[model samples]
Target: MKTLDFWFDTVSPYAYLAFERLPQALEGISYSVRYRPLLFGALLKHWGQLGPAEFEPKRAWTLRQVHWQARELGVELALPAQHPFNPLALQRLALACGDVDGLPNRRVVEALFHHVWRGGGADASDPARLQALQAELRPALDPQGGEVKQRLRALTEEAIALGLFGVPTIAFEGKLFWGLDALPMLRAAMLGDAWFDGPWNEVARPQPGVRRR
Candidate 1:
């Protein structure tokens, strides 16, 4: 079976969006999804960029687009109290959950995304918050916090070694599909379904009821 390398940081709005939609979106498929948890700062360091809000126009545009998608997805998203919540523990906890045998990693990841993105909760850094999240997610994960945290450190190091740059990245075979907008293309690639082949903006005037993707 084909596997998708699902990389995401909790702070990313797009990642937040994908977390809510991925499972059902890929139902009936033959692919396994693996979560690759990493720190956003590590990747941003490569581009010499700080957080998004500091970037003005880009942040403004992104907020607008994210809000639009949030409304479309019907998920409540408040402006986070701060940007770039410390992701170390969060990633570690996820790694622990991922390591659990027969545990639902995707479901827990979805819950983490919802908690972080929907409630403006700071999860990546807060152990209590992370503990609460794990409890609400799965009993098996809730009991393995220490081991999970230890494994998270290892995963972070692994992410650095993998040359990971960002979150919400979907990798299949050896190719990486970045962002939620790429989900359709990733789905297509897996199913041998090609919706677009040539120019993307060919339809200057689209039908009234038709939605792209």
Candidate 2:
């Protein structure tokens, strides 16, 4: 069976949106999904780029776009009080949930995404909240333990080595499909469809308000 590696951060609204829709969207597809939780802030720092929330215009547009996209997907979306909350413990909690192939673990990940994005629980960095979530998610494994912390760091490093620059990246057979917009393209690729041969060309049009030299 083919596997699709999905890297995501709980802090990313786009990731939340994608996660909510993927199970249903991929209903007919013959592929196994593997969710890899990683720290998006670390990736951003390594890439020397500012996140969408770093700029006012981008942040405003992103917030609006997420809501619009959620409506389009028929999924309810609510923004957290903090745009970019710390997701270290959350990532570790995801690891503690065990294999992504299991329904319980997948559900826990989905629940966490909903808690942050739809539930408006905000402040994932808070130890109390993280602990509560970890317990509620998977009490058997210790998310705050040293082993899980190391495992989370290792996963982040592995993602960096895999050329993952952003969350919600879908990888299969050494090819990567980035962002929610790329989901269709990834599906096409899986079906052996050449949907992205080249960029579309456009003809230039005359401007009515331009002054002649």
Candidate 3:
């Protein structure tokens, strides 16, 4: 079976949106999905490439763009006051849960995303807060929902070894699709056997003629 390797961090809001929709997008497609969790911020540091919103101008533009895109896509999102929070533990937990059938741990991931963007879950750095979150959801913070901490840790380390440095990176048949905007392309690739052979198969090609302004 074709495999869709999904790489993401728990704190990534866009990743959250994608996670909520991907399975439906892949329903008719022939493929197996795999999750590879990693540290979002840490990965960026290793590549010398900062995130999309590191600058003032970009940040301002991004907020507007995010709002516009969210409206069009029907997913609401905003940078919460509690942003840049530590999502290491959450990612570890997600990595573990990624393997279980039906992704039972997705509820927690979805909840964390909503908690961060929809409300005040952004300030959830305190361990007690996570514990409380756990008590409210699954029993004792893991594995009950098919959550696996140890494997997630290994997967994060594996991602580091694979030279990965971004959240929402999907590797299909050795091709990597990074970022949310790439989701459509990913869906197209996923649904088609000619994913690597289509006329517009420029996903991995070099377009030197297309100049960047």
On lDDT, the leading prediction is 2
lDDT of 1 by residue, 92-197 (tens): 5566566444223777777767667766644444667666776665544533467665555565566666666667787776656778787777777778654334
- Tens-digit lDDT string for candidate 3 (1-103): 7877778775666676677667766677777666556777767776666665666687667656766766777876766665456777666545434433523
The full ranking of all candidates by lDDT, starting with the best, is 2, 1, 3
Judging by TM-score, tell me the better candidate of 2 and 3: 2
* Residue 179 in candidate 3, Cα distance off native in Å: 1.5
Error of 1 at 163 (Å): 4.3
TM-score of candidate 1 relative to the true fold? 0.71
Alpha-carbon error at 111 in model 3, in Å? 2.6
User: Against the hidden true structure, what lDDT does model 1 obtain?
Assistant: 0.68
**Could you give the candidate ranking by TM-score, starting with the highest?**
2, 3, 1
Worst 10 residues of 2 by lDDT: 195-204
TM-score between candidate 3 and the true structure: 0.72
Question: lDDT by residue for model 2 over 1-213, one digit each (tens)?
Answer: 668888889889888888887767666778877788888888898888888877999999999998899999999888887777677767777877776332135677887887787666456566676667676765456777887778778878988999899978888778777788878777777776654343311222445787553
lDDT against true structure, model 3? 0.65
lDDT, each prediction: 0.68, 0.77, 0.65
